[model samples]
Target chain A: MASADNVGILGWGAYIPIYRISSDEIARVWGFDDKIPDSIWVEEKAVGAIDEDTVTMSWEASRYALMRSGIDPSEIGAVFVGTESKPYSVKPTATIVAEALGIPPKKLASDLEFACRAASEAIRISIGLVKSQIAKATLVIGADTAQGAPGDLLEFSASSGAAAYIIGNPNQAAAVIVASNSYITDTPDFWRRDGAPYPEHGEIFTGEPAYFHHIVNAVNGLFEEYGFTPKDFDYAVFHQPNGKFPLQVGAKLGFDREKILPGIVTPYVGNTYNGSALLGLAKVLDIAKEDEWILVAPFGSGAGADAYAIRVTDKIEEKRSLAPTVEELIKRKILISYGEYTKMRGKIRKYER
Target chain B: MFKDSVPKYWRLRDVVYRLKYIYCRDCGKSSFPPRSKCPYCGSSNIDHRYSKGNGVVEEYTVMYQSEARYQDYQPIVFGVIRLDEGFRIVAPIVDVDPNSVEEGMRVEATLRRVRVDGSTGLIQYGIKFRPSRR
Candidate 1:
């Protein structure tokens, strides 16, 4: 449903780690051919430091969101972190983020898991909260340090990053949330068992049956309900499992390649999983002009997808520079070796008493 | 024997999370790791404040040795930062080359994993500094 009230994005921010490992490095170590990275359309992927995790990245991104919005931490009514890579299995990552941001004792705080679409769901939930007046504003974060087996194709794409947004009154928003909806199913194209460190996928089954099916259905659901066509939007961002999937999906949905190109980030930073589509939206927000329309479709392989129609406002020009832009964060990189990547990712066993 | 205590970390959450300080209104100075009594003027009249997180490195050193738990993150650069507001606190510098850090370099605060008790214990998170872009 379209928000009855004026619920919009107050601010947006992203955090990408500086460390990087090329697809070539991963390929060489695993005895894969050189064209493997090219086949996936990923050159390099961002890596979190040994000391960093989902919680720390979420805090950094949220801090910037607060800075851009100029909102006091106590005023936030809800906090949500969507990730598959939470540091602790039982402890909540959201409380740690809320506390680090000084968001006070009274707030709706919890972690949500839907593979990758959890943060997208957080945004949809925040829109409802603001529309109903249950909260004046809310913080929604998408972050991940996704895992892949040593010799698996996922190793080239499972990376780390975070994107955060503040949802509040439309009058204070940089971009208004026109409408949003989600589509989900019992499709199990990708999964990791409860205690498994690395996830397994259904290979090509992840493409058409999982990612494409859920995302197309979600976007079509919005189009059918809202009467919006592909031509109506100035830009479209899809969950980027690789550099090629977004373009392929966009083409399938009748959107031009040009409209989807600006939002594709997986080629450079790898698939930040939760951060993939959100980070693309953040980049578009940084460069989009007043009144421009953006189509956001984020898919998670459990599987599900959330589609949002966003309209930019004049406030974007002023608020865009309040925090570091996604492009700038992506450029601040230090390439590491395959061995270093293994170390940072904790692939090595450690001794303990 | 105890590796660490939850109460110790919980009690100092504010300071640990945000780098909080107590500004002695009477003395016009800020004391970090905030306390009820001001160290400079011995006054109880103080207000809790958070550092703007902008600072400059006053001095720094790289530690190649540490307790076993911290071995994964060795060659850690420890620096004494003087916040833009003019109070000094020591913290680890991350996201940059350890050998490249120098005196008077600009820095900014960021939350990070300070330590973890073990596989089953709490993961303590606190404020750390990194090279500032602006």
Candidate 2:
């Protein structure tokens, strides 16, 4: 087996749907004071039309990663789909995506559900696959069409998006996986009861107890264990439920705003749940120079964080031809009305039948 | 659910018989029964579109018994057929001996009544594939 550091990301891709819904409109309908920032912190949110879901979004992101990596689908030895919003309760969303991508049945495939951090977990699992030589390439996808009760803060921010990374041997990698650390706690700040349409979350409790505590702990742990200071990293991205949290956390950690600002995606697209932080990291990698260091920390509602330190490589410049950059996606947005947002979010009517 | 009260189509799905499958024009993919959209391309842009309905058997298995509603038709033959257009479907083969069903054997889709619920229930028709006439 190869050393753990031998495994790294070979390629990365992201997808944020074309639609956007303004926060001011949400504040008007919910009767909140217009002066107050809508709970989401974004002017608008991206939504997936009826046909899109975690499975579809993951497929799109994976397709781009595969194309960018120039790796054949048949060569993928394992596929992990990290999602909270699976299409079916019993069926595995990974199998659906694997089949569509033409991954053979002999490969290891499964779905992971750990609130928002599931995709980061998938990345770790793929790293193990590459290090052990069990597979030459593994595809890790984090995607969600997250839902929140209508009129709740989560509703304004819970959006749809996906991100995928192809993990393989470092010598064959597009970016070197330097170090990773995790901080976990059994906190129930947010949860959805079974058969419930939307998730219920504790308002202020989600911040300090769940998001801030876990992310800060993981980032500090990574720095301490790896013997690197915050300044050693060039780019940092966090699981963004809203724009304010990442900036606030960065300030507390003694990091400047400019270091974190470039990777922030929530202010424009709202919270993508599972895809939030990872998609931002994908955006950063698109423009980062070779050998530049990057720090990624993702937090979930149940209270867990996965922090990775990566170093970009020359291969990223070559692979960029196959996938769309964050700038391209942001520029191509389509505005939608408040009522359309309700319909797209599946809050207005039951159309599954 | 009681065997007698079950719908004819639900009961027919139990018995061994061939049925027709349809493909969509926009995506060029075949599906069993029929679907409103191509699951791969997610295009509602679909047509009832006929199936060339001919393919080769991909795999097969025989069952000793089926559900209570299909108890009358014991010993069922089930298999997945790979169509000529590159889509695969699952169904029961008919009008041929069980031993004769092998992988790569040419088959054609046909309309057949798979099962009848009780004595006075509706006769449900479905599309199933069988040994091709050609």
Find the candidate with the highest TM-score and give its number. 1
What are the candidates' individual DockQ scores? Answer: 0.67, 0.03
Q: List the residue pairs that clash in candidate 1.
A: none
TM-score of each: 0.98, 0.72
lDDT of 2 by residue, A1-353 (tens): 12136577888888877778878888888997775554446767888754467776787688778877778888899999988997677768887677656687879999998999998998888777887889889999999998977788676788888899889868767788878889999999999888888998887899898898999999998888877688888998888988889888888777888989999998888788889999989889888988898889998878799888888888878888677787677666768887877765657653221
Model 1: residues with Cα > 4 Å off, grouped in runs:
A1-6
Superposed model 2: Cα runs more than 4 Å off: A1-4, A38-40, A350-353, B1-134
Index of the highest-lDDT prediction = 1
Q: Considering only chain B, what TM-score does candidate 2 achieve? A: 0.71
lDDT of 2: 0.77
Q: How far is candidate 1 from the true structure (C-alpha RMSD, Å)?
A: 1.3
Looking at candidate 2 chain A, the ten consecutive residues that score lowest on lDDT are A344-353
> What would the TM-score be for candidate 2 when compared with the true structure?
0.72
Model 2, residue A28: distance off in Å is 1.6
Q: lDDT at A176 for candidate 1?
A: 91
By DockQ thresholds, what CAPRI class is model 1?
medium
Candidate 1, A207: how far from true, in Å? 0.5
Clashing pairs in 2: B18-B127, B18-B128, B18-B129, B19-B127, B19-B128, B19-B129, B20-B127, B20-B128
